[model samples]
Target: MHKSYVGRRRKNPARIEMQEGNETPTRDQIESVVSLYNGGELDAAHAATTELIEKFPAASILHNIRGAVNARKGNHEGAAKDFQNAIDTNPAFPDAYNNLGVALKKLGRQQEAIENYRRAVSIKPDYAEAYFNMANALRDLGRQEDAVSNYKQTLRIAPKHNGARNNLGVLLNKLQRYEEAVSQFSAVLLANPNFADAYNNLGLALKNIGREEEALASFAKATEVKPDYAEAHYNKGSYLFDLGRRQEAEASYAEALRLKPDFAEAFRSLGAVKRYEKDDPQIPYIKSLLDRNDISDNDRMHLNYALGKVSEDLGQHREAFTHYQNANFLRKKFLNYTPDLERRLFRMVRESFEDVERIKNIYRAPAEPFRKTPIFVVGMPRSGTSLTEHILASHSQIYGAGELTTFGMAVNSVWSGGEVTAEQLQTIREKYLADMNRRDVAEPFITDKMHLNYRWIGFICMALPGAKIVHIKRRSIASCWSIFKYYFSDFGNGYAYDLDDLGEYYASYMDLMKFWEERFPGAIYNFSYESLTENQEEETRKLLDYLGLDLEQSCIDFHETKRAVATISSMQVRRKLYKGSSEEWRKYENFLKPLIARLGED
Candidate 1:
């Protein structure tokens, strides 16, 4: 949400000349008009500038000032015209070009806006504001890497530009460069101590890096600095919820909703933490927001999900299905998603791993030296991966590194397609182990619960022979329904939005797992999620026995473990194991025929 700083006000305007025999305006005349504009009297400034422009039609400074006034008055068309006039009179005016770009951006002409910003920066390479403006436009256009470059350029020209630094950090966070994002946000706080958004963003990056305490403190500080910051409150709630502080998290979400009643995210988060009664007041309040014409599709989407949860809890299955349908439809439209992208990746992975003996031969070499063995928990999302990881992490000998993307990154960097070379396997192993070793945990093992890593089972087996891989299986219908009902922050789960896509994706995943299991027999440990839930102690003993570890009491009492869980199952895992979760989907069976058909009654 970086704003474009149009340009600084012109202080000295005595250099301009009038036509022959015409009197030039005094300094007082120009300053008076600027004073009106600076004082927020946009109408008076516009009127005064018009009078002065009539007298000195070639006065570039007057046109620029009037453009600023027009922009303040929400007359971007007039502002654009005035800025163009200023550029016409003084062709080398960087400020006029930059200001015109801002107007063009407001008018939804991003390409034209970028052209004006380019002209401004070309005239004066040190124009940090113009560079920052160009970055904003580039970001809006989804050219994130280009935006990062320009933001860096702005910071280079103006080191103290908090906006550019903060925006750069936000992009970095989105890119999953959390450590780098933390550095940027920390630097922003040093420069602007009172920056609440920076603190909120800092909290996000810190949380991503597993600095839970510091992250919570940063979020609290953001709310302390700006009590009216609804977004910060929402973020604080999310963090608190991740830490299993349900009561505090509820209070924070309530505060956020109180501050900004239309905050749809807050409503959804509040819904997540609550077990609604039939007569809950939040139902009517959330429904009222839907009736507002000003509500955006994004807001409406979240609200629908919130309502869906409430309906489901109230035993209104049909109503819940309707809400989920609306939410998924809007989400699909917003994402403009197609399942082909993921299906193609799945196909490529299968093709690459078809030569199983080659993979084994290439990866048979000794793995990187590690004090702690790496355990990978791979499965479809919402399929008990988080629960399994939490259970394992509760063991004294194991630590849970929730959903690390290091393995995928390493594989993507070194292995393209077809047979992976021994050298590439070594590279991936080193990269992944290097990242893991940085955590420096004292435990004998650590779990990586990136569920989508099911595609990389073959790679994991080859690269890290010491690593233990656990594949959790759940009922396909239960998994798909759970996935469809929840909003995944990661866009990789785009297939979850459509029933056919989800079913097809799940089929591919199952096929890939089967191939991996066949290619590398005895390398993978397969377990059923339902069996684990139904027979907790017996299944726990078997799982631990496979990993050559004793089943500790903590593993059985995983619910009592005091660690942060950052998934939709966070709350569920905090409670003792329960059955009937697989049966909850049956309530909406009539509405889920499409999904049922795709999954074949599984």
Candidate 2:
């Protein structure tokens, strides 16, 4: 009889575990309820659980099972209440607490869910499930570092925790720890062997670090693992797009949208693909989605922005500007509107007055110290840096090194280390120059267009004493508005989130420019984007003459050059120079009233 009972118990682990724990209602009772709930007999499960609860009023197990069923039916508040009842009846039931936390987290109560997770972990120190739930709560709260620690702890207790590992990788990637993230995602594949999202993310991480081939292999593997994975198709398309494989890229984008009709990212990519001549097919869909009550305001805002791009491409500049303005306005209503960044901007007139004496001390005419020179274009994004670069790049003897990360890397090494020997500095300077030596593009002079290099102008001058810097400037409202409307994949432009933050950043830029002008006179040149577009020929000639490059027809036919452009303005630069967008901010006068007041008063 004992042996028969033992065999029967081995066949039902949940029953034995529940019996051992002395919980009311059998494990069989809960399993029966779960089966009914999953098999569309949810009403039966509710009736069974209610009867069990009446027989044993403090039956936490019945309450927990009922809560899971309620969660399935989208009754989040009901599930939360039932889970709370379970915890209240049996305070030591860790699984019930975890379930309650999940329900609360689904409702976006991150802080409260975290408290429940903490309680579950406290009651059951080895509760790996609770740890995972805690990590999720922390991630929802935007406390990513804390979430990572919790996730790592879960995996430490259960090495085969694929879900935890994959989530950890996603968080690390968002934090820009690409290599570390790659390792975690790879480990998840090793454990689960079929995680498509993990494989897709691994590809992105590898690509970010310049391992393009391996990234492509990972993405291919993701599609192989799950042919229906729209994200993998999108990933493949974006990669192909970057590689300049137009046909294959478009096909991939189309495939992704076919698999998932509401894939907005895919729509954005389609718009980008057709942007050269404005062959957009996604605008109609976006327009239809713009008035969707089911979608978010934020989604609608991005849709408007997409419609704006379509109009902009179709030569409807005014309509495009209006849509972009609306998008920026709608996006501002979000909580993370914008954050502060430490980029420098130039304000010349007051800077001249304040730095009059300092400039007198620092200013000295160049003695023609070096026959060879490289001009550095330093400024904010969309601040005429690219235009300045294209003009110089068109020069007969100058090469355009578009957006070189070298100078910033060197300066970061200096700042992060806080000390550098003369030999070290010389090595860095050589690296900077060697960076300009691209494949078959040798020239007497090159343009180092590290836009953010404006902050490190002092270090830049110290390293290359003969280098000339062009600080590209744009109007404050226009620049901030442009940034806000631009969606970013990285963290550098946090000011895109908020109007106040944009204003604060503009103020910071002004201060830095003032400091640099005082500290390094004649080291930086200012070229406002507005002014440059207004007087293109004169500015082009003046800029080229400064670099000692003689005038050439190539400079005039800059738009005709078929050079590779990686910036978002790549397609726009391929056309003739025009002043179509000279007064883009005028239409948004009502929207910018506050911003204008702020800038005007200052």
Candidate 3:
């Protein structure tokens, strides 16, 4: 990851097209609909689009208009269907492809969504707007380098494209090119003064470079311009939290949550406040919210995840498992797919990691540019990477960016575009390094706890000579069984139907780790999960010192920090370090005994 304000673009810049033909049977009707849409009469536009389609069923233009209207009205599924209808009606229509991609992305069909976006640009090379949409989709698909190039492409074609420029600024920030990101954000402000998000993000880039006072001013202007902006408020609150401005930070965090209640992060932040008994009014906020069924589905899903924490903390494993399972269910429900998609995704991730050396080809040249590297905490999902991150993040110098996919994204960008050569690999590696520089943490360190990064560690080190790998180790049974019960929402295998896959996957991961350690001695830091649980302080101190940094008292008390953690262990990590987690597998020992035998654990 580059830095706090990097890797993402300015919010939702691309707009769907609404066409009106001067010569047609429904020419007057089309003009009237266009007038209504231009005047923000979305309902009237929708009706007209429907009527026009009824009268002229072959018109892609009418379908596109309907899709735009549906999109504006927050009917993304409807908008996506209409856009797809437009595409089906006119297969070569680039605008429809772009709009369909945006709608599909909003609807959480990311892979297909990105493919549509890519097709849009391919069909219309000079369509800067299509490139902008493509860039956004690429960023979401975790293909940051391509997004960077596309953002640049939009700006190259249209320099005054404030949106693309702003997005480039964000990507630069992720690339760890703070000065460049700042300049880009400043450039957006120059072009359009009321871009509140740009100012807020500018402040992030500024704060990253240690420009505290200037960062504060930018954040304040962002909030002043858009008081309801949750991110701006959150940014200011984070700054205040750092400065120990407890009351001010609490108010800001509260305001942020007030505006975006479905934000799992704000709730997690509030939970952290409660954990520390920070000078903030902390109720059973998340729990109390869950008691009400009137809340939105998004809120319910997050509540279930948070509830798992409370249950776990209260020694309610059964309740914890149920809520986590529900959370896992709900997060996946956002993706509208048949049963086949899961199998496809499994193959996709598996196949990518199959050839270790081929995967190595994804890393850009870092021999000269990227000397200092981050601590890569790689292990199974529940194998204590979060805990390791939290422990290490407790250090005064190393701020936890939290489970980022910067390295994987950069690597994936290489193969994701399909199998490549020596030249393509080198080009992508440089492009991604440039992207990484935008995220910040270009120098000494950053924690990219993308646990899956474990599979790519060998390839990563080969690409970037100075790269450091921390192999977070956990007992085989403990890791596998923990994953089986809690369930994961994002990737496949968390809901794997068979025990054989889980066991084999576990064995494969361990074997991979062993091979890497043997091949590249001193490249991996093997920290046993059980050992760390027994001696967090000593081990954490050792880990920090190994990175050549002095440990702060604060690092030892990482639980006291009030930051938003997005992992399954967010709730657990907020509380003081405890030993019970080490005993977690015991509860399900009877259930996992056969699985243990599969691991050949006699």
Candidate 4:
């Protein structure tokens, strides 16, 4: 009889655990109620528990069981009340407090939930479940470091706690600690080989660190383990899209949407891959989704941007402008931007590098050992940086390390009181190069087309004297119009959202470039976008000669280059040069009066 009871207790862990140190209810009674609740018979369990509580009104365990049933039924308010009743009846009951926290968390009362969890752990110091619950609440509250600590504590107490381990991995990924995140996810997979979500998360961590092949293998493994995983397919599509495999990306996104019909993000990504030439059928289907009242704000933003792209492709200039305007307006609501903040930064940069004497004095310091000369393509956004990069990357000796932020980040890290030392310069240079090498760049002349590096020209000259700076210039109207029409993911491009802000920012950029040119004469090579388009051969030869490289016909035939381009101009760069992009802005000249007024062109 004793052996049979122990076997039954093994199958009903929750009931046996709850009955410990409690005498009101026999083990059989507790098992009966808990079994009904655990088996998905919520209504029947609730009725039985209500009768049990009436018979044993002061039974704290029965109240906790009823609260668990209420929570499962999504009656969080009722659950909180029942859990509080249990706690009040037996103030030392740790399970009652823990269950109450779960109910409060479901109600979005995270602070209250955290307090209850603390009470649970205080009553029972080794309560691994309460620690895990508290960690989740902390993560939701954006206290990531505290969440990480609590999750670690949870795992220490309960070594096989899979939930804590997986969540810790996710929080680490958000914090950009990809290596640690990979380890956590790997441990999860080792414990349970069929854990599909862990495999997907491990792939994301691997991708963040530039291990593309390994990441893809992990994503493939997830799909193999869970054949119907829509999110894994969507992630695969996103990775392919980033690598410029548009056809494969389209197929992956389509499969994701087929598996989950209401997947709005997959639909938006599919539209991006379509490239929306004249009269694409997907345009109308995307527009039809806007009529659905349940569409999310993010989905609406993507749809508006897609509509703008399709309209632009079809040569509906006015309609395209309207959609672009709506999209920017919607996105701007979520960003913290002010024109004055940018203007002030520009002012500070100019003043910092104002004196040529001070710059020369810094140059007089000992120079670092000369390394390979890197070509920096610096200019305003949409000023033909991508085109110039594509042209230069066609050279066998040059590798295009697209739009590196390493120099900019290094400058931000070391800038102090307008003074820099030779040692500091060398440190910055070595750090920047180390970052580039990690990206697998080994060419003698790599092009860092980080357009905003225009602001860091003085630092670049001091740190890397061998580096060649190419300044790409575009006409003001065309540049501003292009910026306004596009959606930039970088928060630093906040000025692009508004016409007046864009104009002012462009003026600041021009002013700073003039300062750099004056301070470092003959250091910058100027290239005009219009000139490049009009005289591809003449300009390409001049650019090649400037870089001291013999002319390669491949530079002129850049369209045939197979390298991946991860820019807004990715599509344009894949085709031969067209002449109309410069003139297209004139069609919307009337609506761009604010921009024209700000540029002092009127």
Identify the candidate with maximal TM-score.
Answer: 1
How many steric overlaps are in each model, in order?
0, 5, 24, 0
Residues 193-235 of candidate 3 have per-residue lDDT tens digits of 9888789889878876667789889998988888787878777
Pairs with backbone N, CA or C atoms under 3 Å apart (clashes), candidate 2: 337-497, 337-498, 338-497, 338-498, 345-509
lDDT per prediction?
A: 0.84, 0.69, 0.70, 0.80
Which scores better on lDDT, 1 or 4? Answer: 1
lDDT of 1 by residue, 433-478 (tens): 7888777588989999988788888788788886898999999889
Rank candidates by lDDT, best first.
Answer: 1, 4, 3, 2
Better of 1 and 2 by lDDT: 1
TM-scores of the candidates are 0.83, 0.67, 0.64, 0.72
Task: Write out the backbone clash pairs for model 1.
Answer: none
Per-residue CA lDDT of model 4 for 1-602, tens digit only, reads 00000000012212114754444677688789989998989899999999989988888888889988888788989999999998888899888888888889988999999999999999999999889889989988978889999999999999888778888888787665677999999998899898888888887777766678898898899889999988888887777766667798889888888888767667656766786766666777878886678887766766777788778778788888888787787767656678877777777777777775766676543455434568999998888999999999999989887766678767776775466566667777877877655554566788899899998888888777768999999888888998998877656788888787788888888888888888889999999999989889999999999999988999999988877565767667777887778887888888898898888764
RMSD of each: 5.2, 10.3, 7.3, 8.1
- Ranking the candidates on TM-score from highest down gives 1, 4, 2, 3
Q: Candidate 4 has which clashing residue pairs, if any?
A: none
Backbone clash total, candidate 2:
5
User: Whole-model lDDT, candidate 4?
Assistant: 0.80
